[model samples]
Target: MQISRLPRFIRYASALALAVLALFAAMRPAAAAPAHKTEGELSYSSHSGLTNSADGSTGTASTGFQVLLPDGTTRDVNTFGEAIAIAGEHRGSTITLFEPVTLSYTVTVPDGTTINLNSQGGVTYAAISGSSEPPLRVESGSTVAIVNTGATQVARVQNPNGVFAIENKGTLLLGSFVQVLVASGGTAVYGNAPQPAPGAFIVDAPGSSRVSAVQVVQPENQTAAYSGSEGETVVDLLAYVATADSGVTVPVFQLRDKPAEDPTTPSGAPDNEWVLATGPGGATVSDADELVTGDYTFTLRPQGATGDYYGYTVTLTVSVTMPQTVDELRETYRQKLAHALAAYAEADYLADDWANIEAAYQQAFDAINAATEETAMQEAVAGFQTAANLVPTAAERLAAEQQRLLAELDQAYAAYDKADYTAEGWAEITAAYEQGRQGIASATSIADAQAAQQAAVSAMAAVAQKPADPGTKPDTIPATGDPAAIAALMGLGGSAMLAVGVVARKRG
Candidate 1:
């Protein structure tokens, strides 16, 4: 019978164990799925004026612009129509211009697509139109040169959202356009455009782009310019404008060698026309061959006659300063990194906090190591300092622990009574309590605070009772004057009297 029941017992035990395991498994949290990362794709194509319609033609027409495809392939796009067709086919792709091209037809860029015209690349006599607001996004370092001679408008961007949106981070050279509706997104517009009508070049939502001001974006301090050891200097200028009618002519600025020279003179002679460096919308003028020294001025020239910069000529003088050597820049970065590392070593932080600090430090170190220029190295050092400032120090942690320990000690002191315990016992507790308080007051680290807290807890537990007086029995009788003693005497007398009466009665 025992052998037969053994299998049943084993089966029951196995089933019970499995049930418990399943319960625990159901209660456990599920693992999170890994996040998917999307890679950016670029397409290269040139603007070739071969085909003039969006008829889906895949011919080998070569536009100066190159489209870099996701599969690392190049496609030739000749006409603005072909460019638009290719852009529509590959959404979120970039069409890079390698050579200057002139297109007479309107270019309507598709959504999520970028048209990049490099420093050497320019698009002339093309009208940019959009089906939706912000149908085209002009990337930085591109130039959209629109020279409208006839009554045709340069750009007419309209969307169902009731806003004509064209995000232009590059330069918009509006030359003699009858009407150019631009949503510059706060970028500047250069060249003169006669606002022949009231709403010719309307600066829509957000901010206006009607050339409010022209300022230097680089040589950060207008008074100082950074010059390389080889005497190469770079200066960047940006024009700020407000929303205005096309009737308002856009202001134009010119760089000159001499400040007293006439601003109205056309930039044809080498002496008058300073070589404007090719870059993003913000004109980055650089003189690599010539060693620029002292202060050079840039003046906003008047457009025609009546279209001056609102009678106020904007001028900026930029002084050239000697650039720091690579070795000097490295030294500066090393010193900054050393300072941050020293600070990290002196402070104690939790494991998680230390991990964050270490990661930030590593990034800064990598940045400095990879940096070859003075600006990049300086940026690395500055970034490291900013990151290091956010880490919590050991002193802060110790201070918090000390505050907690002090509060616990105060509570312990409140619960203790000197009269309840013997003098020797209470004295011992008092000493321990004082020691704990002193430890807390003098605590310099988290460990010291913890030790102080332990001492306080021990003092709370060391409560001893007062010792009993000598020669005092628990069951001893009371004195004569006491109430208990009087009751005892009266009982004794009554018992004796009763005994005497019984004896007398027996004698009788």
Candidate 2:
């Protein structure tokens, strides 16, 4: 009957149940284990001299230069005699050469390195005793260029492909011909024609290349001039167009040579000798006017020895296209808006005519930007046209206003001269008129002149009525101390008193 003695089956069952619970708890999935990562450090050991290395920053140590690797690791370079040895560093790490770098030994430019060289500095390679070529070689995809600004500066490169460009605007004298080798997708620009004095250089496969300076053959009566051959007298015109996007500015066309424009001289010819005319394409050679989209030709006829027109004919075609696409329209609209705003800024905004025109233009431009349909755009265009007609152009209005102000100033002068006013009044009026005249003279626009005119008018009216001079003021009576004057006054008083007494007595 005592509970202390449990049945054998019950005790065994309890034990088994406890064991099953423990097994289930162990089978449950454990919390996700933290991800494990491997980290690498830039190992540095100086074999020859003391080397200072930075792990995550750029610094200079007695041994070498240390740079932070892209992988959050630090690399310390201890030896930097000529060009620092960085071939063992990251693949795409950039090494900037701030000073002249000498490659006494073979130095391979890591792939995708951007090597910026000083214009005044240069890169030279030492010729190995046994090798016929310089020890330096630039790897493909390595970009190199000179930082020189003027054409006078020069950049010399030992390995061509190592530098992307020889010189952007300056001269580039290659130590070896490899300098002209452009990268796979890079361009090599030579400041001028590559001359061969040391040796002829070969250019490897570059995506593209450009020469800043090239000699253009002048147009002649015949190709045989200076030579002894008869051929067609033909000339090619450099194509020109004036349209820009994203606020970019394009150079204008010049109908002359690059350096020398005087064609009559030995180096050039007179620009007027050639005439530009509308070709069959109906295009005109106008710089200010938007040319019609078509072909334009330039024709020139030289006088022959016989005093007759030469049989040769020369022509050039120019194609013009107006804005038609949305982008083009937007750019054109911005240009027009700038022009209109400049004019409006110079106009007399206080005047109803100018203000109205300006407001209309602003509204039209706003509508143009807000319009989503062609009809709305057309409406805005029409509105702008109407507003333009409401007032004269900015220049015309300013000129006319100045003329009117001048006339008004002259009239004011005449009125001041004719008016019969005192000197003081005249001074006030003249002062006002002079101030107004000065304003008008210095006025940049019509509003300024109008304001000046008002000032003059106000001055003229500010003069009060002409003052009249009272005749010399009577002298004050002297002290009544003179006996003669006192007697006279007493006699007059007695006479007046006697007459008054007689009249009073008679009336009584």
Candidate 3:
């Protein structure tokens, strides 16, 4: 009984020790590590016919235009000039600023229109005004400027909405949440908490350097934001209305509140969806796959004319449907390969050239046969098409080969006439020659001509090794018109070897 009690006491002591060690481990703090970040500088440029479509309906500087509506619908603007004159038909009509287009006249935004200023180009918002009811929202980028100075109640700042300003001689009434980059000589009137808030009023000495910024954010816990002298911030309040393309109109943009930027953190890629289109038409757009199945919008600006440098606009909405099914795609590829193969087979394939080509075709065909899925089969078909186009036209190949065979026949006859042979040997030689000549005359292809050429070479060989006449002396051979010529022909040279077949016989 005492021994059992001792064992229980030892177990309790071990458990208590383990609990003390766990508590000590929990008291230690973890080592902290600093986070790393990266940022990219904003770049700006402008170009013409930036985007166009296939089939030629819309093009850069081309006659027709298209307006993208809010509901993913498009309005065709018959001419570039017509598109610029009429305000858009829809209430939430929106237009994207693709390039800098100088306005011939002042443009006004009706009650509820928004403009999206893309980040890729420097745009000048010259002589522009928004209706007092629902003010225009502009999404700014690297280079964008608003120049307006005539009205009252003209600007109001809605935090997280947009920056606003009212006009004075050199004095301007700025909103509460404003991001400003005071350029050289640009001055601002601070609005204090007890009085008005700071950075609420800014004045641009009429002839001072214009201010520029990528973005500015409202400070935390402050009634009014500060007016810092640093002008490196990039602002983004993009807005535009073009009179060309039959009054292209866009909805008022919903500008976001300026946010604080940590110096240590890196910036990211621009939030703009604009893409540069190189060629005239055949514009394709998809977020991930080739067959897009939902509604999407693509904006295109025709490359500005080379000499005039005036850019054009085309905005369109497309609803992509699922293309072919796997089986359907397989069938299409099969048909295409079949057609190519048929065309190639009808062509004349030179024996030397066809050797490699035939091997390549067979490889592709084998791949197709081994394919277990649609993609693999499609790849095989592509390989086959590439090989098939290399074959030459049948007529051209046949003519070239026929001429070659004709030359060989002439050489064979010449060699035959010079050879010394008995009457029986001559008869055998003549029969084979006539057979080859007929084969050549009637041949319609390279293969047939090749066969004919081979037969002629055999006739020359038979004439060369004809047995001596039975009555003639064994050492006395028939007279060869030219012994030297006969010896040269027998020692086949150049293309002569092409005609001769290998046989184990000595020359007489």
Candidate 4:
């Protein structure tokens, strides 16, 4: 029994020793890994015309925004303008403030119709109980839009929803910022009218801006002007009656809520949505996504050639969504890349296309950080490097992307050089080049992409040193240093050797 136990102990001790060695190996920082992993910021967005099929109470059409955050192994819908978590390939991971933001939405609820806390932006945080969630916000101003779009021709205002006084809509005070302006599309028809594809309109407010709701439109009286200064707290509702398609004359805005102000006769104020619209001048209310965030007042008034006449009213309920996620970011990136590349491809294409150059490279990096599969990361890297090299000039190549890739290459090459730029050195460079190549498919044209792929294959062939027939030497050998240029030259030979360790370590 003692002898048998002794053998078992020795085996156990040996196993422990192997584990320590493996751990030490693991701790050595992944050989030539890039200094900074941008996996969290990379993404691939496709506008499948799929429109976010998922419905929300907000009623806005969907934006085909999908994202692959860093450290995450899966892909998901980047809803509510929230940034995808960047740390892992798993869902619900976070990348902090690093995610690029691109969201613009506006929601207009009809007058007398009340919208609640469910319409504010940055809905990604912990919930809070309150008498007021203060969700409504108007971007760049003090007044909010009160757009009326209801089946009955009017979404009436629920009186006294959340009242606050304001100067003109533009003063944009410090605490409560409320300003009234005509929304580009009053109704924001998500399912009906046009404009925003599916999501709501988003507003951008730097800080400390406030928009109030249901403020009175003061007469020419001193109190009729500003809110902070002894001015009357009023609703600034600018109304434009579509006199024609290319032109619209500002109409009369009826004054409401002044104690002395009479409802029967117009007091030179704007039109309040007192009665349902039944004529050609009727308003249409559409759904918009995340608008600005804060308190707001929406006033509607019709205008005409004879000064401002009494028009109808419309109240809008707006929603503010924040952290605009990677989908929007991808859209922005795609557009910029296309524009930049188009410019770079000109016969006299001399510009570096730096903006897109960085974005494309970053996209590749982000893909790697977010993807869990080693294959995915390697492919993403390869594609990225390919795109990075296509920008047509060395000036463009001197950018951050180049610096980063070069740095990583330097480290990898250094490792190889340490091993004597031998077969292993060539193998490592080959891997780096392959990783960079994989990132190009989605980033460039098919013709250009195929060219890159062919180039890569030829490179592999050269590295492996094959003959016309596996048994005989080729007519020509690949040149040295240009591992990817071709394999027909006498360059360091090794492709199979490089991919072996990666496959064993990651795929296995």
Candidate 5:
């Protein structure tokens, strides 16, 4: 009876221990799981024309902007902030815009990344945060149109650090409604606008005939008179209203002779009637014959119907001198050509690139020498300047060559197999690689560095392969053993040795 009671106690004790272990597990906190890294591409596409019929949806599907992740998955994003958040999570990702859209909110691009706007892509009516290391790049062939609507300015690029923040290589269309402020170290490579000042911006269109603020010389008093030469282009008198409180239409103005009393109508005969002209930024006088030596009063208003005047009006006097002489035009061309040649000499191009530069200079020289008109000589000088700007400097060429050599050396080292070659051959390959590495590190010229890299590659190709080992046997055998048995044992031993050799070769 005592023994039976002892077994029951032991069973009760085991149950109590199991209960205690369960309680401890329930009270302890669980370990946290590791976070997943967000990587790869995140693309944004606005389904511009897709309908519900294509998606087989019962109701109207939301045709807003959708983001495609790297894992071949996509989700609809409602705001620009959502898209930016998704893009920021993916390290070193590219944001591709598929359709034209206006973002009302501010876009802060991540560091060391690019936002590519395709042919049909554009962004306007938004503020882009400035960056120096990772610039706000406007790709070629894309048109980024900035237009003001009422009191709101089109776009504002803020760079307080005074670094180059905007890199515009494409077309930037600026309407006459507002001044798109791009302050502090903004670069425009392919536009007609002038270089940006420290606090002011440049409005540039590569092929458009619009006159920007850079071309206009505005005095302190609005009623002041401006003078120009007789041969000056009519665009010189055009005025661009730089304000942010108007619509998208260009300014329209009427030019007429200054009146004596009223100042609205011409003081002379009826033949001196008002000449009407219109343009996107300012009025363009197509015929130069209309511009005579006279004081003109022009009234500027926003382009609209007959009775609507959305913008302000301006009246000014313009005086033109007699047409320039032929000798004066020739002297002007000579001065411009001299300046262009000086600039060409200052551009420190690579040694090999000098041939192209010389050829361009010779062509410019011949064209200017034979040119009879001022326009032809100016064109030749402009062409030469453009050619000179395209050549890379000596330092830039050397850096590129060094990068190429380093990449090739890395590939060679990754593909090398040490076990396939003999010990002596592997040593030779290692020495060659070290020599190439040292040469690249201390190289001052492109040619010497390339030679060193080539030598290492050649040495790697000449590496010798290891020879297979042949098995051997003892000369004497025991006389007491059977001849057949001895022969079988020897054959088995040889087979085993060969198998070991094969295994060793594979392991190597």
Candidate 6:
């Protein structure tokens, strides 16, 4: 079929119509939703001038001195602030003060400073303040207060809680109190380092200082360190005895020792004799001996709960002295006592002899006693402590325990000799007593006193029944085993153990 072509103008007209329709369709998508229109400038008025600012961001504004609502505008402000706010924009615009404003200030008139008359607020003295804090203002309804007994400043208040209208810099005079707290970053207004108590201000925090709180400090006392060359000499020692479960007290000591001892005056015999000893409760060391012209070790220990304690270290020192045997010591003591006694006999010449007499008595004590660790009071206490087994056999703890026991044993023998025994016959009897005491005091937690008694009896029996010492015997019964000696050996062990047990229980 022959296609009849329409006129060019007609075709053009159709094409134009289609183009127009397409355009309308595309435009419809954008035009269908209405957009918000730009309104007129916002109106704002304030009597306080411009007091704040708003920073603009993303075509939106941040807060400023004064605010204009509709157009998102603002103005600067100074004082009696007043503003009319309106909301039109979707964004959150902020209004801020020009700077960190001074909340308030307090001026303290130090004592003796003559306070002059003032109108309002505190004294503004540029001489003292330099360029730091601003002058304080007394707001309306606020009264100027003085700490001391004088009128320091004045206040003019128009309305309650309103600012006190100040005129100019000439409003303040000299010698008036300066309100430090008025300016931002101002020096702290302090009457003094805050007093501890019964004062004007109290710090909220416990230990804070910095003019915010009170503090007490004293100068430390420092003593000159001891150098062996000059001061008085002394000797000290420490020993410990505790059960396996008990806490340990270590010695804190500058231990000293003698490499060699001076020989006796007549030649070969040992002189300046020494021995280790402990103090009451095993807390400190005392009476250390066995010296030459040299060094000796000393130590200290601390007390603890029944089972827990710490050892301490201490320096023990003794001055170099002439050699002396036990016999010599006894003789010296005798002479001293005799001299003192003779003086006492002379009524007019008698001086206080209590100390000298005691010394003499102790000297005589030496003659009557063999000086065994067994009878030592402290050693006895320690001996009973051996049962505790707090430390193993291999460690120094064992050696220390044995030492303590030996000291007791020595003391015991000494006592036995002085009591009913003799130095010559002091033998198995003493050993037996020590063993018995050891058994009674062992850490096993015996059921009752009967058990303890039985243990003591058994220990005594052990010594009594011991086989004869086949070799080397004593020269004197008094030195070995006299009747007094035997009886002492028999009873001391158990008695000591019982005493120890009592002490332990009391401590607990």
Q: Which tens-of-lDDT digit does each residue in 415-485 have in candidate 5?
A: 77787567897888888888887787678788888988998887776665554334635355523333444
lDDT of 6 by residue, 1-508 (tens): 2224877787789889999999989877554666653542323354344322321113222122333333446443332122212211212322232222222332322222121112122323211121222223322322222121122331111111222212111111212121222232222322222222211222222222111211111112111112232222334111211211112222211111111121111122111112333322333334443323333333223232321121212233322343555555545544544444453222221133334444444544444344333234233233323322222233233344444544554455444432332343345555555664564345233233235444544443334222324484535443354444466556767899999999999999
**What's the CA RMSD of model 5 in angstroms?**
26.7
Best by TM-score: 5
Of the two candidates 1 and 4, the one with more favorable TM-score, higher being better, is 1
Which candidate model has the greater lDDT, 3 or 4? 3
> Considering summed lDDT, which 10 consecutive residues are worst modelled in model 1?
211-220
> How do all models score by TM-score?
0.27, 0.23, 0.24, 0.17, 0.30, 0.15
* Of 2 and 4, the candidate ranking higher by TM-score: 2
Local lDDT at 340 for model 2: 55
| Residue range 165-229, candidate 3, lDDT tens digits | 21212222233223232222322222221111222223233443322212212212111111212
State the C-alpha lDDT per candidate: 0.49, 0.44, 0.41, 0.33, 0.49, 0.32
The sequence of per-residue lDDT tens digits that candidate 1 reaches over residues 254-277 is 222121123233243222122233
Error of 1 at 12 (Å): 99
Candidate 1, residue 145: how far the Cα is off, in Å:
64
| Candidate 6 segments whose C-alpha is farther than 4 A from its true place | 1-426, 444-452, 462-508
Supply candidate 1's per-residue lDDT for 168. Answer: 52
lDDT of 4 by residue, 1-508 (tens): 4545678879788789999999999888656856864334323343222222232333232332233343434333343232222212233332111111222222221122111111222212111111222222322322222221111111121112132111122222111111222122221111111111111121222231221122223322111111121221211111212112213222233222221123223445443332112211233322221222222233334443443332234443212122324554444444544444454433332344665566776787577556555556557656766786666553333343444443543354343332324566467557745654563333234344445545544444344321234576545543455444355332434666667778898976
Task: Specify the poorest-scoring 10-residue window by lDDT in model 2.
Answer: 223-232
Ranking by lDDT: 1, 5, 2, 3, 4, 6
